[model samples]
Target: MTQTPSSSGREGGRSLKTRVKTARKRSLSSTLWLARQLNDPYVARAKREGLRSRAAYKLIEIDERWHFLKPGQRVVDLGAAPGGWSQVAARAVGAEAGRGRVLGIDLLEMEPLPGVEFKVMDFLEAEAPRQLMEWLGGKADVVLSDMAANATGHKKTDHLRIIGLVELAADFACEVLAEGGSFLAKVIQGGTEHELLARLKREFAVVRHVKPQASRADSAELYVLATGFRGAPGA
Candidate 1:
């Protein structure tokens, strides 16, 4: 009797071959993307340190400069697919932080990670924040959203979509953040809506936008950071 290849094994091999062929078909662009990934110090460092994604470095760098995360703080991460930012928050808050927690939510499926809670749901839905608060048991110390809408190749439309998402995230943050808490959300380069900025300025003691070094230079995405929440409109 001869051993035979399993059906799963055969299918896996076929899939691998298809991927190789696809890579070959787009060799130029694929090569550039691969080269950039290979040469990225953050990529190398993430692999060496066993982090989930290179995007982790963005949060790490931001925290390093701003000192937003603390040992026993509660955090909420929106658009946390691939678990990079969640991983960083978990480590910073520690397992025994005592009521300190991190909640990560995304529309896409994500792999399970220890020390952080994850939900597969869209934050834009009205019930999502209520569910998250139930899990958190209280208001968060920081709410961070890196959500970006899929670009449609129309610059104005894309910018407007991103701003809409940012505005929603800000509103959600104002509802869930404790007094003196912080909110950070990704925005586009054309500047945020005047109404939104005005609201932030009135509610927070400090509000500013920053473009992290980890962000691509040509990218229009920036981050709006607001601190010292003064309670939502009616509180």
Candidate 2:
């Protein structure tokens, strides 16, 4: 990872923009991505603060604004590989050792964290939700999904895939969230999300979109938060 620096005014000061030299084996896109990651303040902050990913700050910012994830709340983190949001939930709900519990599910293995039970399983699997609920001991007070399908570099296909993932997450959340619970998921910037917002409005008292400062300005990612779940339609 070679870095080329620009003019700076202060001691050890460097331009926010980091430039990387491309190697024979690395594509220009990958090199650019590496350069961005290297210069991202949130990435550096995550390391200093002992968080798993810079994405953790996005959760922190949203929760701080909305005042959700209280102590003793049962929380579920879907597609929780890397376990950044799981860590935040565990701390918020006092899950280190108490009534509050956090369960995380993902297809990828995650390193263990205090007070978080992580299962390497696909949430789309038929039996996964039941297992997660059993670990939580009851319905969840909050459900979070940072899940996204691997980008295929085709904007249209990528948007559809993420929307589908969010819809699946919403369905799972509605089934397992206690009345008055909350749901939050990452979504791409696009038109299809309107339908999702409408569906959520039917079941939640408040629904809103949030773009945390942690999200790269150039990225088209945002989070949709719905709170005060009104319970299943027939319940």
Candidate 3:
């Protein structure tokens, strides 16, 4: 992997851009994405810091502001491929110190990380919540989802698809989060639907949107954070 340039994509007062030549088999979009990854400071930083992926910084930034993910807490990370969020959670919650526990679930198998247990299964499966709780030995203190649907060219359709994912993740969080726990999930610029936002407000004491600096300026991705979960009705 190429070493990351400075945050400004410059070094020693010289601008640097990693350009990718289009391969015969590679599409223009793929070439552009490769180039962007090569030039992204966060990507280089992640490599230098020995982190799993760039997504780790997003969680780290949010947690730094909120001071969530305390020691001895339990955390759940949905769609935790490459284990970036899981890595951050494990460290913040002191999982390596055996003070906390982290569970990472995804359809794709993760290479594995200390202090984190990876489960290769669809989080959308009917029994996923139950199984996750069983693995964690109880409810989680924080539930995170960085999952995003593959975008179609249609903007509205892409927004709806991501909202649908957030709704499902919120529902799952409610099922498995302990009282006063937190839930965070990825959403986009169009924002979450009214019904879902209203529901989150009712379920959690604080619900708001946050976009970390690690997220690209041109990208519409943002996160919805709901803290102080109030347990199920009549529980």
Which residue window of length 10 is worst by lDDT in model 2?
1-10
Task: Give me the overall lDDT of model 1.
Answer: 0.78
What TM-score do all the candidates reach, one by one?
A: 0.82, 0.92, 0.95
Q: If both were scored by TM-score, which would come out higher, candidate 1 or candidate 3?
A: 3
Deviating ranges (above 4 Å) for candidate 2: 1-18
TM-score of 2: 0.92
Better of 2 and 3 by lDDT: 3
| Best candidate (score: TM-score) | 3
lDDT of each: 0.78, 0.88, 0.90
> Which ranking of candidates, highest TM-score first?
3, 2, 1
RMSD of 3: 2.8
- Candidate 1, residues 1-235, lDDT tens digits: the string is 1111112223444532222223546777676667666556566667867789877777777777777888888899999888888888888878334446888888888888777888888777888777777888888889988888898989989989988888899888988888999988888887546777888999898988777776766678778889899876676
Q: Write the per-residue lDDT of candidate 2 for residues 160-229, one digit (tens) a residue.
A: 9999999999999998999999999999998988889999999899999999877888999999999999
List, residue by residue over 128-153, the lDDT tens digit for candidate 3: 98998899899999999999999898
- The model with the greatest lDDT is 3
